[model samples]
Target chain A: MTLDFWGLGLQAVNVLILVWLLTRVFWRPVAAAIVARQTAAQALLSDAEGTQAKADAALAEVTKAREEIAAERAAMLASAAQEAEVAVQAKMAEARAKAEALVEAAKVAQGHAAEAARKEQTRQAATLAVEIAGKLLARLDPNAVQGAFLAQLVAAVEGLPEQDRAALTRGGTLVSAAALDDAGQARIAEALGKMPGLTFVVDPALIAGFVLRTQHVVLHDSWQSDLDHILKDLRHAA
Target chain B: MNSPLDAVALFQIGPVPITQAILTTWGIMAVLLLGAFALTRRLTLTPGRRQAALELIVTTMDTQIRETTGAEPAPYRGFIGTLFLFILVANWSSLIPGLDPPTAQLETDAALAVLVFLSVIWFGVQGGGVAGYLRSFASPNVVMIPLNMLESVTRVFSMFVRLFGNVMSGVFVIGIVASLAGLLVPIPLMALDLLTGLVQAYIFAVLAMVFISATVEDGTPKSQKET
Candidate 1:
């Protein structure tokens, strides 16, 4: 039995051709697909890692911002506290100043009231002294006082205008504290000779002096009139 | 019956005689080439079930090549993977009714062994140089050169004889058993033949890889031998 040399050559050629065909169709393509899948997986992993890093960075930024906000909030609280303290201090000072003003004003008002009361007392004391002087003058000797009053009256009459003296002489009455003696009356008439028609009238309320009266002319020269004028000046001073 | 050792020509093309083995080899080649094209038509990064199974086969081939040779699988994948797939399919082709497996033929095994021998030389030359490939025969010392050269031919011839003997014996024994006993009696033997076919295919592919790598390693400088 002989070997089939032609079949052997043909089988070897067939296998060689199969190897070349399978290389292109099977082996290379499958290996390439595996490589491609691996590459894609690697890319996805890289992207995921990048995203994680970004998230970490963003978290760090947010944390930093939160810390800053906390610090800012603390600063605001401190500032508010400081401002509140200043406002409280200012309010306290204002209240204290107002209280001081009220107290000072009250003291000033009290002092002014005391001074007014003292002045009032002084006016009252002056009025009482005038009244006492009036009483003391009244207790003096009536005739001597009368004479002195008449002398003063004559001197006042001589210094008067002619019309006044004539009006007194024509119808004027001499009001006296008591009925004057003839000597006093004659002396008064001589001193005021133009007033011959002067009448003598007794008015004890005059105290110890006289007033000469006419229709429009009256000369007051009495203790009561002097005391009344002193009282009016004291009232004005008060 | 014609001897399994003999390949009687069915026809002739001028000086070349076309036998049943050649026709069967052509059918196997056509089926494998067309089937491979169809299987790998739609390869993608995301794989379908078909693509996954295909990738599994290629990956397994790469692993075996890597494990056996301790070298990168890319350069040897086509030659080594094709040898294993073709031999396994050819060995199992005996399952078809009335068809003898192509590996059972002495000439087919011899042709396979001759291709392995040629590939060893080719790969050796590519690894180092022509001078380096020639020098690999004189490895260890000049005295071993003649023995080494004779051993190379004998080793290849032994691989051919081993494959032919196992496949032919299984087929011949099954034929005799079927002729002597009933049809069902040969089933276990046929099953054993299937196991024998698988083991022989594996052994043949591994031996081819070892032989090729031995030549390449011997020819190459120690520094450049990493490839």
Candidate 2:
């Protein structure tokens, strides 16, 4: 075999040129594109992660706010309930006080009404008694009635205390329910007029007996006064 | 009969002589350059069919380079891929009538081996530094330094002889059979020659890879070096 050194040298140079050309034309750009794509994909993933983190944070904040609002609402509801209870209690107390006051007023009015009714009953009894006495006296003999009354007057005058008798003996007036005869008047004047200025007054209100009133003393022995005392005792016992 | 020993001188350029093998080599280079230009014209991040195919080819070669050398394939990809493509295309060109394959010539095979030899040194120095590469010759013992040195030269020579002998014999056998059997009978031989041509191209590329890796690895055992 013939060895051509010049041909070998040219072929080597040709191979070197082809190798340099192919590296420049093809391999470098393709590799660069691949690396760039990988970098871009990584960047996109990082951005997605950041967005997810932000979303999680915002959700947590919202949850916290909701919990706070719920607590506030609960507090307000409790306070409202307390205020409602207080207002209800106050209304109940006021109503109870008003009821007690109404009861007290009714009791006072009932007492007053009872007192008035008793007074009216006593007045009616006294009038009926006076009417019956007057009828009975009209049926009796005048001399006999005057005699009985004179005896009672003398007895009542003698029963008085010494000081009251002395005061009565001073100038005084005698009031009686019935007109008296001259003898009867003379008897009464003699019984009561130890001092002088003795006068007699006929008063229909003193139904059956006399009332002697002196400047310092008064003595009443009348049906109306006796009935009024009896009625007062009855009220006291009740 | 076309003598496989001699490269036919086709023309000359001033003092530099141009031959048929050089012309054929130029044509191959032009076709490769034009194809690369067309494929890369509108490269997109999203690839179409043609770009996909191109990427597959590039990636396959890169993987091979990485596997063979146990190094980053980037620097080695261009030279290794170019050698494989040129030899493969040159050997297959024999299918065309009246056109001799460039690899069938002694000069082309020698030139390929020379480039491989030079690349081995370049990569070795780049990996190990010149000093370390020189020191590797004295490995296993300084007494074997001469034998190791002779082994490097002979290996490169064997690469040249192996490729040239296989391709030239294929062509010569096909030619002799075509003449003796009057055309139709030589078809089987031609088909067999196609297989032989492909196998020879693969052997040439693989040997070149082994030689370059051996220098870079420096003190690897003989079995690992073969792998």
Whole-model Cα lDDT per candidate?
A: 0.86, 0.78
Per-model TM against the reference: 0.62, 0.57
Candidate 1 C-alpha lDDT tens digits along B17-89: 8877777788888888889888888877789999889888888988998899887888888888888988899
Strongest candidate by lDDT: 1
Candidate 1 accuracy as TM-score? 0.62
Regions more than 4 Å wrong, model 1: A59-238, B225-227
What lDDT, from 0 to 1, does candidate 2 have?
Answer: 0.78
The local lDDT score (0 to 100) that residue A27 gets in candidate 1 is 81
For candidate 2, write residues A1-238 as lDDT tens digits. Answer: 5677788899889878988887777676555555565677788889988998998999999999999999999999999999999999999999999999999999999988988887777666656665676566556664565467667877788777877777776778877777767777767656654534657888866555667788987777765556556655654544
- Superposed Cα deviation of residue B61, candidate 2 (Å): 1.2
The reply for model 2, stretches above 4 Å from the true place, is A41-238, B182-192, B219-227
* DockQ of all predictions against the true structure, Cα-based: 0.53, 0.40
